[model samples]
Target: MSLFNVFDISGTAMSAQSVRLNTTASNLSNANSVSSSIDQTYRARHPVFAAEMNRATANMDDKASVGVKVLGVVESDKPLTVEYNPNHPMADKDGYIYKPNVNVMEEMANMISASRSYQTNIQIADSAKKMLSRTLRLGQ
Candidate 1:
């Protein structure tokens, strides 16, 4: 791969991480939302990613290489937690309030991971730029 390809790879990674962070933020924001019924409860969402292989080289012999691609966002399949609270305003007839399956600690951990990935990509791109500049200076 060409040295310039580093930028493309890192750029895609950064973009993917941005989407991840956005979804994590959304999940965290709705963590405390209450609903009277399961159907109305907010579900935690996560971004699905898939590696985008190079279409130009259809030959598998080329040693398949890929970049990041966001397949789509999917809701968590885990069951929602229901709490019996008769005093709750959103409680249903059964006196149970539905809460989102989102876990605050998990979301916080994901946020930190995404942030670190973004920073790493930025540093990679910055280093590539510096190296290219230094190479050009050698000709002067």
Candidate 2:
């Protein structure tokens, strides 16, 4: 792999982590939201990622590097939280209020992890840049 490829890989990883962070933030924002029905309640969303790769033909076998690819964002299928709150204005006719299935702690953790991953990618790109710079200096 070339030094330039490192930047591309890290850039794609950072983009993927950014999407993860955004989803985590969205989930956290809707964590306390209440609704009268389960369908109307917010659900935690997560981004799916896949490892992109390129394989050479049989005539000339060579491995090609591909960056990270985002599959899609998916909503959590877990059960929504149900609570009996007769006094709540948004309560259903049965005096039940529905809350999002999002877990605040879990979302927070995801945010932290995503942030760290992004930081790591930045560091990787920086290191690659430094290496390339030093290599150029070697010729001078």
Candidate 3:
């Protein structure tokens, strides 16, 4: 693969990680939100990613240079947590409050994993740039 391919791959990864971080933050922000009904509660969201293969180049079989693309964002289908809070203003007729299904622990873990992956991609891009620079000096 060409040295420039590294930048494309890493850039895609960084973009994907940014989406992940944003979703994680949104999930965490809504973790404590309460609603009177399940439909009104906020559900955790996550972005789906897919590998974008080069469809334009039929003869070029360079698979290593392909990058990732965000397929879409999906909300969690998990059931909302219901709690009995008669004193809460948003409590339903049965004195139940609906809370988001978001798991704080899982979201935190995802944030850490996404961050590490982003850092790794950055390091790979940096290393590739250093190698390319050294290669340019080889004839000197």
Candidate 4:
């Protein structure tokens, strides 16, 4: 892969991580939200990513450089939490309230991971820029 491709790779990685962070934030924001029914409760959402190989790299037998692509965001299939709260205004007729499936601890971990990934990608791009600048200086 060309040195310039590093920027593209890092850019895509940053974008993907941004989406991940956004989803994690959204999940955390709604973590405590309650609904009258399970169907109305918010489910934790996560971004799905896929590696996109450059067309030129397809035929190469060596390691292929790839960028990231967000396939989509998917809601967790895990069941929502059902709590018995007879006094709650949103409680159902059965004296139960449904909470979002989002887990605060898990969302915090995901946020940290996404932040680190974004930082790593920034470092990669910075290194690539430095290498490119030094290479150009050599010709002067």
Candidate 5:
């Protein structure tokens, strides 16, 4: 793979991580939301990613770097939390309120992981830039 390909790989990775962070944020924001029924409750959303092969390098002898691509965001299939709150205004006829399936601790962990991955990609791009600059200086 060419040294320039590092930038493209890192850029794609950063973009994917940004989406992940955003989804995590959205899930956390709605963690406390209550609904009268399961259909009205929010489901935790997660970003799906897939590695895309570099077409340019596919036919070449050298292995090409794979870029990250976001497949899409999917809602968690886990069951939502059902709480009994007779006094709650939004409670159903059975005095049950529906809560989102989001786990606060899990979302926080996901946020930290996504942020760190994003930072790692930035560092990779910065390192590639420095390497390229040093290579140019060698001709001076």
Candidate 6:
């Protein structure tokens, strides 16, 4: 891998983390949303990630992983929260309201993790910049 590939890898990683953070934020924002029917209830959304690969050389045996790739966003399959709140304005004919499957604590943790990951990537890019600058200075 080339030394400059570091920036590409870290940049893609940061983009993936941004997607993660966005999905986490959307999940958190809809965490409290209620619906009168199961079909109308919101579900927690999560991002799917995969590693992007590149052909390092003409040699068939040589391959290099370039960076992170976002496969897609998917909704959690976990069951939604069902509450027996007949008094609630959104209650259905069965007097039950449906809440999103999003867990606030889990979403909060995801937010923190994504943020830290983004920050780490930024630090990595900064380090690479500093290294390149020092190399240029050495040539001066």
Count backbone overlaps in model 3: 0
lDDT tens digits, residue span 1-140, model 3: 78898899999999999999999999999999999998899999999998776542542665467778999999999999999999999999999999999999999999999999999999999999999999999989
Poorly placed runs, candidate 3 (over 4 Å): 54-64
Cα miss at 77, model 4 (Å)? Answer: 0.6
Pairs in steric clash, model 6: none
Model 1 segments beyond 4 Å from truth?
Answer: 54-65
How many steric clashes between backbone atoms does each model show?
0, 0, 0, 0, 0, 0
| Candidate 5 residue-wise lDDT at 36 | 99
Alpha-carbon shift of residue 86 in model 1 (angstroms): 1.4
Off by over 4 Å in 2: 54-62
lDDT top scorer: 5
TM-scores of the candidates in the order shown = 0.91, 0.93, 0.93, 0.93, 0.94, 0.92
Candidate 2 steric clashes: 0
lDDT of 4 at 87: 100
Candidate 5's clash total is 0
Candidate that beats the other on lDDT, 1 or 5, i.e. the better one: 5
Give the lDDT of residue 111 in candidate 3: 100
Candidate 4 matches the true fold with a TM-score of 0.93
Query: Candidate 4: where are CA atoms >4 Å away?
Result: 54-64
Tens digits of per-residue lDDT, candidate 1, 15-116, equal 999999999999999999999999999999999988776542684665444668898999999999999999999999989999999999999999999999
The alpha-carbon deviation from the true structure for residue 64 of candidate 3, after best TM-score superposition, in angstroms, is 6.6
Model 2 per-residue lDDT tens digits across residues 67-97: 7889999999999999999999999999999
